[model samples]
Target: MSQHIQRSIDSPLRTGLNREQLWEDHDKGLIKCWEVGRQRAARFPELANQCLAGELPVLGWKGGVSRSLKKLEKFGSLKYLAQWQGLRGEDLNIDLSEERELTCSRTAMVVTFTPDRSKYFNQVAEA
Candidate 1:
């Protein structure tokens, strides 16, 4: 029998994965998933961390990861600014216009915003 089948047949107590062990395993799995996400973000250094985090809300992208990144950039959450030093402007400017056009082609609405002094004053008063 396969190890998976053997594990399935074994009781939790016999297998040594008690409640605490099960919880630890669950936490480890979560950490592994988070590490994978971080690795992906590292591979695409041009994209913002917010873009990667937003993937969960949009249900894992379904082969639309590039589209999601463009949407984040369009909405101003992801800017052209570099997050770290040692990155050249020329290197980072890799066909962004084409990517943006392709990704945002199907977008229904694209909203851009700028904050005014009035909004800041209101926020200060509320705080």
Candidate 2:
């Protein structure tokens, strides 16, 4: 008629360990984990969205998506830029450095590109 006993939080105090320090260390670890997740998502946002939407697993190198926004700037309006804008529902913000929106928009551009951007891709690839 007995249940398993657990050590009370004060047990650590009895052994001279500070509970406040333990909590602070635990919090820092959690913060680092969250930051890493954010960076991972930023790097491959379509993959993040696909994994979240249950479309696919978190494959870092998701095919046909995850193109860098930096590389995308090479395509001009004559080369399906309107298609990207319409598909992504946002303009390519060239000056963006570290903002999350830019990552999302850029990933959306890649996702929207792979299907019908052969002409543009060929043109860019040859140059």
Candidate 3:
């Protein structure tokens, strides 16, 4: 049973990334935060550290690692289809249309569940 802890959404770290540019680049599938970090590290690890420490700007965005990751998760190519806190917690159904369904729990237990995307998608298509 591993616990998925929620990380801080903000920090002193900053990237010189413009908000619009960041979103635009993400929308264009140019690159993701992880990729950006990898590129920065490859190019200049020291500068990357400075960017992470808020001593320098990166991609024109002023945000911490967690914030960057969140933004990437939201707009990046990756898809987080579902997230469940527990058996009692509400089920968050994320569909292609971004419509979320909040369904009450019928049992008690902190169990997070996520369906296999490929299988689920195949089933849906077949139906």
Which is the leading candidate under lDDT? Answer: 2
The sequence of per-residue lDDT tens digits that candidate 1 reaches over residues 1-127 is 1111011111122244455654345232222223333444557554434343322111131112233333343321112111110111111221212222212233332322111223223321100
1-127: candidate 3 lDDT, tens digit per residue? 3222221222222367676765455232122333344444556656545433433122322111222221121111112211111111212222232322222122111111122234223321100
- Ranked by TM-score, the better of candidates 2 and 3 is 2
User: How far off is residue 71 in model 1, in Å?
Assistant: 19
What lDDT score belongs to each candidate, Candidate 1 first? 0.26, 0.30, 0.27
Which of candidates 1 and 3 is the stronger one according to lDDT?
Answer: 3
Those runs of model 2 whose alpha carbons end farther than 4 Å from true positions after fitting are 1-24, 54-127
Tell me the deviation in Å of residue 115 in model 3.
Answer: 26
Name model 3 segments beyond 4 Å from true.
Answer: 1-31, 52-56, 60-127
- Model 3 C-alpha lDDT versus the unseen true structure: 0.27
Q: Rank the candidates by lDDT, best first.
A: 2, 3, 1
lDDT of 1 at 92: 24
RMSD of 2: 19.3
lDDT of 2 at 71: 55
Residue 14: error of model 3 in Å? 25
Report lDDT (Cα) of residue 57, candidate 2. 27
